[model samples]
Target: MRSLLVTGGAGFIGANFVRLWARERPADRITVLDALTYAGNRANLANVKAELVVGDIRDEALVDQLLASREVDTIVHFAAESHVDRSISGPDAFVETNVVGTHALLKAARRAWLGDGARRPHRFHHISTDEVYGTLGPEDPPFTETTPYAPNSPYSASKAASDHLVRAYHHTFGLETTTSNCSNNYGPFQFPEKLIPLFLLNALEGRPLPIYGDGMQVRDWLHVEDHCRGIMAVIDRGRPGETYNIGGGAELPNLVVIDTLCRAIDDAFAADPSLTRRFPDAPAARGLPTASLKTFVADRPGHDRRYAIDCSKARDELGYAPRHDFASGFAQTVAWYLANEPWWRAIRDGSYRAAA
Candidate 1:
């Protein structure tokens, strides 16, 4: 695509996608539209050379204006309210942003870009999560592209609704669209509220590492860079009106993941013992030690037990393969958080703290 519109480009995955696309194809023009919510940060795109538009995706007039004025042929939509815990506490924002906002963007895209007979070249790529498939039993196979959506939480339900809207727009209105449902993403620039980064940051800061329920919930972790590459593959080669499952194929239990993080943190501190004294007053840094900070909390309502994706469709169709194994990806991720404290520190101590 020559000129593209990236919604939620300041958010974690969106920002990574923007950075990747910008680096991979420097000649292409990009315009980022983000609401700058708690999860969205302009610093994520500090080095990007694309145009940055700070606005909500729900603004029909603004979305239309951008699509028309920028001559955007491709729209990579990544905007959504993603946290399940936040959704439980306040679901209205999820409905408004994920469902209604997607509708508005679809309408605007149809009106502004597809109004003419020049149709085949235009595309709308929707980035979604695998939670739409609900929890999977240990004996069950991974979720494939054909899996029926059985969303349990408000967040997943809202994403499922948005997916349906994208499909409807393609079938009824003939809007060229592609949807990709991805597994859990963990990598650089992720907000600290997420499981990996939360535990990592909390462990580093000598705070309690909270684990919901018994911490056996399983998630298939995909590196954010791999996810961005998968999205690029889908946007470039995926057939319109098709849904692809993008997965890292690495599944681990929640508690196992936490323990892995603890070990990583221990090694990190051992490499530089001075870090232990950096936070003198924190309990995790004091008598209790890091591993002892693990605290199991009451699970939230409707928490999914397991989610895994069958991404053979993407691998077979788009020639997409994840290069980083879990160990490598997790190391890179942990290093990023350790190296870039200022980026996540503001969010951790600011408005995003409530979600944490």
Candidate 2:
């Protein structure tokens, strides 16, 4: 059985990955190392069968201890500051977490697995974002695995640096490493700072749904579960020192996504009258359209106009394909948010952090 150490396993994508991995690979031992920051909530991994180590990834000593104690043979590095606007407003945290934290993990992995000319069966999988390829013009082709790095924002730039570090470690130290740069992932446990959950929560609370600029910015929306599956595929079959692009195969503008989310909420309320009582503040409860809440706001700096990924390499090499289509995925996501009010409500009211 493989012993896996998953960094940031309490955060959105990492938690989903942990849950999926635990469920699918029941025999494998899973140990989670998370800092449990504002974005990384312990509640996200409520009932997962894994050892949760609440610690920063930057602490190489701590990482080394975890590796030695857990006998970890695989390290899935997902710990990073991922918010674009937060990176724009304050970039120091992003640099420290994404770049520095990743380096620490690489160093610890090298020390534990490659020190003293000793080699073990191990894999280091790094999760990254497609934004590192920069924006695409309206008529441009999608970003492929071979796309040149042109990160525009601090968050993406830090991720690019981390990706380079992963590559360097693989090439110089002969570490078994693979990287997957995925498109936007949306599903359960996502913080409201992101577009989908933010707009959904705002519409439910009768607040303005702020649309940045004209909201024409396009993105590929990969369901978080699909992303987890893609990651699993890479770990199971991909070659070391290779980079794979994992995409949802659904590219749409931000406006379209918001509109669809609003409609999904409306449909849910119509299908179940009790939803009106559950979310009384929702515009749908008042027999009004959720679209009414949408309002344009000034765009943030370095907002990419479009991001699309071509995962042909992953498809050909690992036989990986996304299972969740946009419509069904959005419906499932809406249902989750509607059902898990308390989970998100705690975050909104500052209680989750207090509980931590």
Candidate 3:
């Protein structure tokens, strides 16, 4: 069985990837390294069977130890300061983690895997964002792997730097590497700070669902599961030193997503009367449309106008296709949040961090 070390495996998309990998490759030994940051909750992996090492990725010594001790053949680097707002407010942390932390991992991998006279068989798959390609105009085509990066936000800029580092390691050290720049992802175990989860939770508590600007900004939404699947395909079949773009094929404006989410919540309450009791404060609980809670606010600085990914490369090369449509995916997301109130509630009230 191949041993794999997943960095940031306790975070939202990372946790989802870990769970998927465990289920799909039962024989593979999985090790997770996370700093247990605010977004990286250990509880996110409560049901998944894997070794969890609570440490920062910037710790090069620790990474080298894990690489040598575990005899890890694959490294899925997912750790990053991902939130745009957080990066805007504090770019230092983003640079330190995304750029510096990634470099540390690369160095450790190079020392452990390539230090010997003979080259080793290993893969370093870096997870990145389409935001690195910057905003698109209304009539612009979706971003491709060949698109020249024009990162606007600090978070995306940091990710762009890390991507370049991964590429550099491949060309300079002959380290086998690949990168996947994915569109927006939404699914279970997501931190509530993101748009979908944050709005969902806010609506449940009678709080206004804040929409930035005109909410016309468009994005291609990829289901986290599909993204994990795409990653697996890349690890298994993709050529070394190449990049793939994974997208859900669900490109819609932010307003449309919010409207759909609101309608989904309303439908959930209507279908299950018990939801009214559970989330009594919700507009749906009072027989009012969940859309009643929408409150448009001022847009954040440097907000990207649009982001779309052209996944034709992945589709043709790796037979990768997103299985979840926005409708079914959004419905499931709403249902997940409803069924796991305690999980998100802990996060919302700051109890999860305290308990951690």
What's each prediction's TM-score? 0.95, 0.99, 0.99
- lDDT of candidate model 1 versus the reference: 0.90
Give lDDT tens digits, candidate 2, residues 96-149: 999999999999999999998999999999999999999999999999999999
Model 1, residue 127: distance off in Å is: 0.6
Off by over 4 Å in 3: none
Give the per-residue Cα lDDT of candidate 2 at 42. Answer: 86
Residue range 52-141, candidate 1, lDDT tens digits: 898999999999899989989999999999999999999999999999999999999998766776563688999999999999999899
Top model number, lDDT: 2
lDDT of each: 0.90, 0.95, 0.94
Q: How many residue pairs clash per model?
A: 0, 0, 0
Tens-digit lDDT track for model 3 on 1-356?
88999999999999999999999889999999999889989889997889999999999989999998999999999999999999989999999999999999999989878897767789999999999999999999999999999999999999999999999999999889999999999999999899999999988899999899999999999999999999999999999999999999999999999999888888888899998988899998999999999999999999999999999999999999999998888888888988898899888888888745
List of clashing residue pairs for candidate 1? none
